[model samples]
Target: MAAGQPVVVLPENVKRYMGRDAQRMNILAGRIIAETVRSTLGPKGMDKMLVDDLGDIVVTNDGVTILKEMSVEHPAAKMLIEVAKTQEKEVGDGTTTAVVIAGELLRKAEELLDQNVHPTIVIKGYQLALEKVQEILKEIAVDVKADDKEMLKKIAMTSITGKGAEKAKEKLGDIIVEAVTAVVDENGKIDKDLIKVEKKEGTSVDETELIRGVVIDKERVNPQMPKKVENAKIALLNCPIEVKETETDAKISITDPSKMMEFIEQEEKMLKDMVDEIKASGANVVFCQKGIDDLAQHYLAKAGILAVRRVKKSDIEKLSKATGANIITNIKDLTAEDLGEAGLVSEEKVAGDAMIFVKECKHPKAVTILARGTTEHVVDEVARAIDDAIGVVACTIEDGKIVAGGGAAEIELAMRLRDYADTVSGREQLAVRGFADALEVIPRTLAENAGLDAIEMLVNLRAKHATEGNARYGLNVFSGEVEDMSENGVVEPLRVKTQAIQSATESSEMLLRIDDVIAAEKLSGKEAGGDMGGMGGMGGMGGMM
Candidate 1:
């Protein structure tokens, strides 16, 4: 109330936007991110060619890959990207569907905002809708047993179908199913890390094959070693065969030339003794994680043993699982029980490079899928597709549940959610209906990407879901018509759909609740200069005083 009083000012370097301004900015950012990946939704979806600053180009229709490649700056947009990543990591598929749903949720929330509905109400409605959708998903999901190989194949086919892997979908599907089935333990636990994917560019994608054992991208340590070993008794070593140096610094004084010669002989004898212990353990093939000394290699070759040096730690672990072998770190402690058995281990030339394959393990808990393609990009894309296929198959085996794909699941959920929305009598009901509308974005985007009228497709899909058994009916991207996705072998793991909806809703709700954005001044050279100038002005004033 006082007149002509000094007023305090916020630092010029700090800026803040609140209320509608903040919400609008965030909504715009989320929508832009969704729009960026929208066109890459369905089988007919377009691919994005992302070129980084170094000019590394990544051309893909996979949502996670595209988002990962893009250098996003906006915080809201980054949140949407996280949604895709979580979907990708959780289910290994349905990333685009998740991101698009989140964007649509935000878009719908914006409409509610304009109608004077509070953000909390919108978030609550979204949460309620999410719970209902999850229940509907459980009801719609079909049970799949471990022995249901046909259904498993269909699941793999569905995952591989709409992407770069479509060209070789059937072959890749068979390989993926076989690979996953091979790695499933007796307790029904599937460790996907046991499955190794190796890509070699030269052959067609259809030439891709599954190896029943591990394949090391290396050759025998020495040329004199056997190129192929039958009935391989593999010894996995983590320690080096070479003589290790002392931990502390020390100098050895050579009294004469004869003493130096004796020192060299002693070192060679130690290396030979290490190799002798490996041979005594009855291991015909050696896979060492560390270096093998030159003397040790010579002794190994002399013993007619196949040896691979400097193997990766991951490969070594996979070999242990594949052959039921134990990795021994001490050479003197080697025993026959520590050796892994493979019917055959051979070093073969593949794509002009030498690689060793440990095959014919009786009951391998690990397997390999050697993916071959004509080009590097094709190989990379095929690898991604195979990864998705493996992921879905593994998830299905782990959870024992599957669902029909081709947007059928989305249509059914949308229809049921709308009916559920009617029972709730509040503004939250509107948000529930908004959630239903958001679910339709999947089929809509599918139809739109396939060059069909989205409105017409959604109408037909809704009508089909109205019937009791036609809930699995969805838009077939290939024919641009509604069909029974289950009968057509279009299926996915139940986890994929559940994760997509859950993550998308959660992300959208988080973004919707943000009411303000306060950005600190960036520490750029210009700002630093301005701060220095201000300090200099203060110094001049003090001198004048």
Candidate 2:
């Protein structure tokens, strides 16, 4: 088995071993894990309130988040979680579906095994069933020919649902598609930082688009700062201020007019020295983190320098990348190329503050993927979904799109697998048939995780697809039978169609035929769940195969 060839499970012995309680524990553990995430599946799915030992609480309907947050003890449950993690990592969209389908598939196989069916026969039957289900899925899938505006919106909506931002979901989709579309290079791939969404303290629908770059809330302190600078060039510095101090311990006490005059003269001399040093450095655009005194600012201004005073410590860093200016804030002198160009000028009043967008820096971390909403919190959630969308989109763009995050489509594939499993012929046929039959439960498991009654939701999907061409009109499978996805859409992301099919096909074949769970290891005593006597707490291990 360790030689790396395909593993196979014979129908008779497979059943005999898994049918025993000890061996069955493996199956039991896997199924239980799958069921745990069943109720948190879709847009309509209810949320899970997970509380950790530290008493931290997370209320989320996101399947992956919930799974990662909760604690599961059973080793089999851990295996199921691993499967979900694989699915999620491979395809950002399908964690819930994988988990849910896996649970029910195990459940059905267990029942069939109890009814005297062998494991190998079920595995064979499921293999046969897989082709049919794939055929059905292909037939059912609506091919979106090219990226049209409407089609692009549909793509965004697919990621927006169950995200709790119903009103802004559709609108945000348009923004994503439109923003990304404009930035697509001649080579056809979107640039990484072209479309960005940042979190801000602003009301909803305050969206603005800029042909040139726009800064979110760039600021500078001091009235002596330049009102405007033409043809501004800037430098970005990563180093800290290394200015030579005039004195290590200098204190001023204004006890007399003579002392006051002396203090003023000393301060003026210090300021003059700082300004003269900066001017000598050759920067017309000076961005400073350390203090810029009034006398220094006046001197720099007189020297024809466009000095930006009191730049925030963080903005100094970010703007540095944009401006191409290296800082010697505390250092005596600087250079021209170090002061990057301050390209554009734009100002805004909203979210209760006057904000300026300074631009044309050499490099910016993220670009704004502007979206409009009606309120503050609404826009906040919209921003969150946008972040998730970015993660999903970026991941898909990187890896080949694997599968839907939710399990609806994959569960259907599993059902097809079970049907295929049923067609096998064997002396140990019954046990194998059990496995094949169990595959049918994948959809129900998905629905259960998403918080819907699996049976009822599947029926609705059938009814809708039969009558209408789309599943959007159908209820969400995870929650109780409910109305459509509302703002949700059923289309897949750009590259996942092939991947989803491939995963379904491969997992079905591997899972059904496997007779035993063997790990080549020195630690053998931890095998607590799988004994030949019977299954663990939940049910028989037949479905687990």
lDDT of each: 0.88, 0.52
- For model 1 the TM-score comes to 0.95
RMSD versus native structure for model 2: 10.3
| Top model number, lDDT | 1
TM-score top scorer: 1
Off by over 4 Å in 2: 1-23, 86-88, 112-147, 182-187, 190-196, 201-234, 241-366, 369-384, 391-489, 494-545
| lDDT tens digits, residue span 1-545, model 1 | 69999775656665566898778877878887898899998778998888888988887888899999887766678889999999888778889989999999999999999999999999999999999999989998989898888889889988887778788988888899999999998889888889999999998998999999999999988999999999999999999999999999989999999999999999999998888899999999999999998889999999999999999999999999999999998999999999999999999888999999999999999999999988888888899889888889999999999888888998888888999999987899999999999889999998999899999999989988896556689889888889988888888899999999999999999988999876554456654433223212121211110
Candidate 1 lDDT for residue 42: 76
How does model 1 fare in lDDT?
A: 0.88
Which pairs clash inside model 1? none
Model 1 bad stretches (over 4 Å): 1-10, 527-545
